[model samples]
Target: MDLDALVGRARSLAGGGATRTVLGLAGPPGAGKSTLAQTLTAALGDAAAYVPLDGFHLSNAQLDRLGLRSRKGSEPSFDVRGYEALLRRLVGEPAREAYVPDFDRSLDEPVAARHLVPAGARLLVTEGNYLACDLPGWREARGLMAEVWYVDAAADLRDARLMRRHTGFGRDEAAARAWIDGNDRPNAELVERSRDRCDLVVTSLAG
Candidate 1:
């Protein structure tokens, strides 16, 4: 996948006048965004932290309260207001370190006060489904990033991966298939429209 290329580019951004700006990676679910983010953060060392958009997802109770559980991955299901505030804070470059939550998929919960970015960090690699979007306040997201990347993969392959993920999470095979075909695909289509907003198109080879 030539992660070194991305690692080197991000490392250089910290050296120059760049204020450890955010790099947004936008892609559909099961698109390997977390994999890429984790890999890049490790490759970049202390200069960067992987800030996830998934942490902004509303809790299950919140979704149930809003009647948005069936549309969980949709844009309307997240705490966009909170996410915007966090982005504002990061862009403000506060002198003190701030704590951000990380989404723990195995537990299907957001781990509180887990990931922290030091004020002097040189770069932040944020990955999520909505960063490159143009819906409502979502458009404001692009303005907060120094750069963006979009990942594209074969649809069949994506579905295969997603179905396996759902089944691994204990869903029955029929339910897993339905999720991949219905909700996931619709969200993927919507997310793909934002690819035009990216600075780079990353087409990864399977490892």
Candidate 2:
């Protein structure tokens, strides 16, 4: 579907004049989920807010302590319970502003409370790789959302985007490819399995 159609769907879920509504964007890494989430928030203006799940990644120190530095982006490396709690607060306490974390790619770390969802924000767009996951904390997190849209693109395109992302973030070309093949490809496969769980499968947002 196109941008207008996606926006229309989100608007309906927002319920116009009712309580806060959350729209989740789930897809594998490099699937353009963040791009779509940001675009929707820009289109909807103040009525909407974007809160990304990557913001809940565990600290590098924590990863090192847990001996998971080599598998940095794996599900076990994230603060899934913390993410669930944030969603709960957002859904249950609509009258208050909630502070959400944001991941800083440059530092490869999470910056605390960098994103604020104002009480007036009726639509919250949260994008990430694991929103549709059936794991303990992840399943409950998905249940909290009003709806989840799974963004998708050609496999080659996703691979290209991921290669550029890793290289841009500091890895050399060889390392980038290696990481994608060894670490990210497996995660992508797992995310692909969760596509059936999403409310919508967004193939494109070209309109």
Candidate 3:
């Protein structure tokens, strides 16, 4: 996406007379959804706060109980209802100080109440793999956002990034490839299904 255009839109939504705006960035793993969302929030500074979907990931214990730890990145592994509820709080019934959880990649765990989005905040920037999906709860998310952007990148690029990310987080190359091939890629495909619903389709980053 053109940095100028994206920044312009963010500034307008943040500065305009609108009450509160929730912006969602959805895409496959390694599509730069998180990075773009962070940059956009930074552009808007205090007017924006981030809410990541990863923090809502079901704990390893819960996944183990369901026999789904192996498919940890899949849509079913998330707390869709919790995310929907938070979005509602962020937009429909915003408050003065809203606390949110953050995910620690190194620990593969969620740290609750790590961040706060103050009341009267202008923008709520949320990023995740399944925000725009046609699935039951995800449909509720699409309803919550004032705008959603789907980041699109090449499959090879995505794979490379995924592999690198896995390795960086302590996985061996083979294990990383296996995880990507067995788990993440399928999740990416499933997440991609919701792209058509995005208000904007971003193809590249702006300088």
Strongest candidate by lDDT: 2
Model 2 worst lDDT window (10 residues): 11-20
Q: What is the lDDT of residue 199 in candidate 3?
A: 92
> What TM-score does each of the candidates earn?
0.92, 0.95, 0.94
Q: What ordering of candidates by TM-score runs from best to worst?
A: 2, 3, 1
- Per-residue lDDT over 1-207 for candidate 3, one digit per residue giving the tens place of the 0 to 100 score: 488789788767662444678888999988988889888888888888888988898988999999999898789999999989988877765556788887888988777998788776788899999999999999998898888889888888888888889999999999999999999989988978888889999974522
Runs in model 1 lying further than 4 Å from the true structure:
15-18
Candidate 2 vs candidate 3: the TM-score winner is: 2
lDDT value for candidate 3? 0.85
> How many residue pairs collide in each prediction?
2, 0, 3
Q: Write the per-residue lDDT of candidate 2 for residues 1-207, one digit (tens) a residue.
A: 767888888877773564787899999888899889999988888788889999988999999999988888888888988988888888777778888899999999999889889887889999999899888899989888999989998888899899989999999999999999998898889899999999999984432
Model 2: lDDT to the true structure: 0.88
Clashing pairs in 1: 20-122, 20-123
Q: Across residues 156-180, which tens digit of lDDT does each residue of candidate 1 receive?
A: 7777788888999889999988877
